[model samples]
Target: MLLAAAVCPHPPLLVPALTGAQDGPPTGPAAEAATAAADLRATCLAAVRDLLATAGPDADVVVVGTGPTPGSAAPDAVGSLSGYGADVTLGLARVTDVPPTGLPSLPLSITIGLWLLREAGYDGPARARVVTQHATPAECADLGARLAAFPALTVLLVMGDGSARRDEKAPGALDERALPFDTAAAEALADADTAALAALDPDLAHDLLATGRAPWQILAGAVEADGRPWKSELRSSDAPYGVGYLVAVWTPA
Candidate 1:
């Protein structure tokens, strides 16, 4: 069976209560919005998962959904990503939207959140189906709870900058709210060489602590910026293993 978790920004996806008479379609706005949304989802998901693989190796990799509507299974869709030993789904709902007097409604931020998940090699399928159905907080929470209870569930990786408290203990869960990306680790990678990072990739090492919940390996590769190699040696301050960061280097044999 597949274990899943739910993570969303507080509040929730806000659809304008009042459908006002609007001007003509904002083509430029729509196009720009779509592009920006895609980029953000990709980047944020990557950063988050990258940090996780480096820091939280025991976590079961997952897919971060995008858009207001949760994802549903498709007949043509390939089953699960058995390679990583985990499954994931994502929704583009703005669960973190604050009201008029609350925090700014940044629906686009979901893009970043989803992106971070992808960057870390967490290419899982989407099981969420609320993005199109307009899910309520209770409904979303209920689904999340079920996922957390899943036997294979190990962690509920939430994005945004907030917190979540899952009551059940069967599948120990974790909620990593809006934490800053580990820029120091990236910088360290920039300064380190591949020789020192071989073990950083899970495939190269077998001693990573395992809780038997979501056990997987991280494959390390050399750093590259703009198609060029970004080389450096990762040090203690830069790469804190078993914390919330992992830094590894890889080279062609």
Candidate 2:
């Protein structure tokens, strides 16, 4: 059963290296965004560390993220940010003698998970799984149930962004509906409301461009399958750079 879970956003900029040169201190809007990103990154790392602790030493971890298709990687799987113009490379495990299997590169969400594990110096066994953004709610729930059935103590690290159209300058442009959707999502996560998360409409989520919809629904499934009391704490919630980024931690009550 899942002992702990953490949710984080997967913006490439979360990595300092991807934030461009630090030749000089940023000013104006850039400075504000940089500060916000830095804080979010720190919070995300802390939440992951807390998750690891909740799972206990050497616990097995399952990292979930959204992608174009469903795929999985072993603990030693390596991912690179070169596509994002950074040469930084990260792996799911702290040390791996295993070489690449010539599989396709990890999607953005899993890559971010890899970075988080490395940053937290997590030395436990962990693997990454990506669910397609278009996956149906039922499919997500099924996957979550399977994950919850892992024999050993398992912790889930879910990575995805809420919405990209929270403001006029947002990536998807400002949408009046975006805020309400994100607000509901944040509330559900904070309350550990599995029903609310499970009931999230795929159509509405797609319309709002909420990348976290499928993954969050998967989490709801896992919680339900585990059939244990849990509580959630909202660590951070904000629309930085017009994208809704929320961080939350859930542990058994």
Candidate 3:
């Protein structure tokens, strides 16, 4: 059964420790972005707490995000940002201390999601699903439905970001369609609009380099699967670094 959910962005910088608070004070090239990210991080953390609160205690947690591979990670799967210049490593749950068996490590998106989970003081065991960026809308929807079918009460911590090409500084560079696309996404997330999410154009998303497409669709599918009335608050919506980072908390109405 599905309980509630929190949606967030998966940028490595969300972990302040990564960039020494990600650009330090508001007086450098990334000044404005730094300030925005700090605010957004606060909102995201709060939203995460709200999700946990809505689910109550002893609820099953499922962490969902976009990644290069599409499937469940080993419960003991490891994640690291050492390659990203942060000398830290994290696990899906507790550190197994053993070598990885199949998957090398949890994908970057899932790894970051786990970091947010830890920051929110959620130290429970969690299942993770990494949807491929190229997955079709129907595929993500199927996965979402399956995720909500777990016997125990379940909560979702969905990780993703909207268009990354909002401006010239964006990774995908400027795209006229980025703003409207992200605006629509932000509105949908704020209102828990599943139909709008399911209708997101993958081709346009791919062109704008929006990695959140699959993960957001999964969220919509999960809500649809639950078929329960839910209300939501869009905690934050901003493209601090030309990447749309949204934070929202959804509770059963």
TM-score of each: 0.28, 0.93, 0.92
For model 2, the superposed segments whose C-alpha errors exceed 4 Å read 21-24, 74-76, 93-104
Give per-residue CA lDDT, model 2, range 111-220, as digits (tens).
89878877887855568888888899999899989889988888999998988999888988988889999999999999999999988888888887899999899899
lDDT of 3: 0.84
- Point to the candidate with the largest lDDT: 2
Q: In angstroms, give how far residue 83 of model 1 lies from its true place.
A: 30
Q: Model 2: which ten-residue window has the lowest total lDDT?
A: 95-104
lDDT of 1 by residue, 84-182 (tens): 223222332322233112222222323323434444455443222222222332334345444434454243333321111111221223322201222
Give residue 204's error in model 3 in angstroms: 1.1
Mind giving the per-residue lDDT tens digits that candidate 3 earns over 138-236? 998898898878889999999988999988988888999999999999899889999999999989989988988999899999899988987889877
Tell how far residue 54 is off in model 3, in angstroms. Answer: 2.0
For candidate 2, give the lDDT of residue 217.
91
Model 3: ten consecutive residues of lowest lDDT? 95-104
